[model samples]
Target: MPVTSIVKDPEALSLTVHAEFPVKVARLWDAYLDARQLEKFWGPAEYPATFTRHDAAAGGRSNYHMTSPEGEEFHGYWEWNEVVEHKFFEVTDGFAHPDGTPNTDLPVNRMVFSFDPTPEGTKLTITAAFDSAEDMEQVVAMGMIDGTRSAMSQIEQVLIDLRNYSQTFATEAELVSDTQVRVVRLVRGTRQQVWDAHHDAALVKRWQYGPDGWSMTKCDLASGIGESYLLWWAPEDGGQGFGFSGKILERVEGHYESSTEQLEGGEEILGSGVPGSVNQQTFTGTTGGTLVTTLITYRDKAARDAMLATGMADGMEASYARLESIL
Candidate 1:
């Protein structure tokens, strides 16, 4: 791994460190914003860190603690002052008590992190400004520079692990029977959140589109059993698009929902003889997060085969991948 460049300016009472990452700016930005990703590289190896609270936005606060090899814990907090997506953020960083209360006895600093895209990858510059030169000296003596470098060295591996995990967790689809197709994904959210993504019209409009250049133009939902729901889609270039409306068959709030879907348009590709399908979705809480299982049962084998031949599974996978971003 490459070493970080650390510069100390006594006259300005500031310390700056420059680190380069062999990854895109979005990946680097996500590593800092996502709590699960942040925990992997926020501290040195011997002193692993865990975040109890993480909200990556202006006016938000993150409280975390590092557990040493000797079993001792050091708590800290960051008050985000400014945040610009994929660019930079400023935070008030300081020590805190175990209960997350500020520790006045410890040194506090204002830190700014700027991210710049490069031909190689992303370059991140972090500058910490102290109240006085004495404060800067005290923190340097306390191993701030060394600890930061060690922590930053772990990010490359973290990004690699994240990439691998995403590939492993991609949505999976299988033909359960001649008339039934099953699609499953392990989403990183609670059962309720996953359910809401399906039931809420606004959220559904955001991720239900299968691929790029397509948008959901309309979404109207009636949550009650026996109610009907309608959705519409259109291409960016004003090309003709297809959509479907469904009648709710079953509803078990936040757990299960079943509907009968009747497709509109694209009849030639979907086979005009193809019948509607009953789509049943189940949300189950799992150790990892929420397991979402969607089963589509056609009226007959011919209908199911026609739908599958139209690349429905590939479209579903793309849509589900988009849902992961919002969650």
Candidate 2:
């Protein structure tokens, strides 16, 4: 592949690599655009990598975060210099704190990626130039090239697998049984704003789901121990269809939990039914700011089985991902 055929510049401090995969440009382009798809493949050479605030558009910005050997997180952002759809794109990259504060000491890089279509497949050429030889040496020693190669290879594989999966499952909706769906991710801009997003019926509908014909008929949010909110879903088929109903049974100043069994119907009878779950949301003061934890418990057995089947511990980890965006 192109990554294996890389050669450093003899006169200048630079490296150029070409990777040729037996995949079409269109397939690779889709993988690059979908944030979810990118999440599956994008990362550095050795350790796992993550991206945030990713807007792959002109004049947009994003941050890449990766963990070190000691579990220290290092992150950087790239403000797009240029974006040319599936053809090529350029960006100016630099180190930064998770909160977008730039670090001045780390060297900045301008990288250009060109995607060219070939008869055999797609050819991707990457050119990243550093300000000095030391900069190049430092990054190479850090194994940046290996990380990039692995990420690109992963992108190609995702495309190939997606095509195969689509063909294999054509008749029905993809069954993500025992999956975690996003409930709400709140980043507190203010105490009142946080409360409104979670408690206000009108505002909740804007960000949360609104099913067909179902609407919030009544909601009450009080401040003391009895403070609570309830949403009554009115099914389109006039109560004969599927609907959802939930209430805040208990509310602490900074947290609340939703009871699953009460909403789904009395506790499940053995294998016949499972109790509704509970969602407990807590807000704590942190050095960075307020950190919120929305812990959801779906009875021990149900939660454990779901985790074991899907390689996920609980919905908390997945919820945290959606929370990162809301915050």
Each candidate: RMSD to true structure?
A: 14.7, 12.5
Candidate 2 Cα deviation (angstroms), residue 105: 1.0
Ten-residue stretch with the least lDDT total in model 1 = 163-172
**Candidate 1 error regions (>4 Å):** 164-327
Each candidate structure's TM-score, on Cα atoms with residue i matched to residue i, is 0.54, 0.52
Q: What TM-score does prediction 1 earn?
A: 0.54
* lDDT at position 223, candidate 1: 74
Q: Over the full model, what C-alpha lDDT does candidate 2 score relative to the true structure?
A: 0.54
In model 2, which regions exceed 4 Å deviation? 1-4, 10-12, 68-70, 164-209, 212-327
| Residue 32 lDDT (model 1) | 79
**What TM-score would candidate 2 get against the native?**
0.52
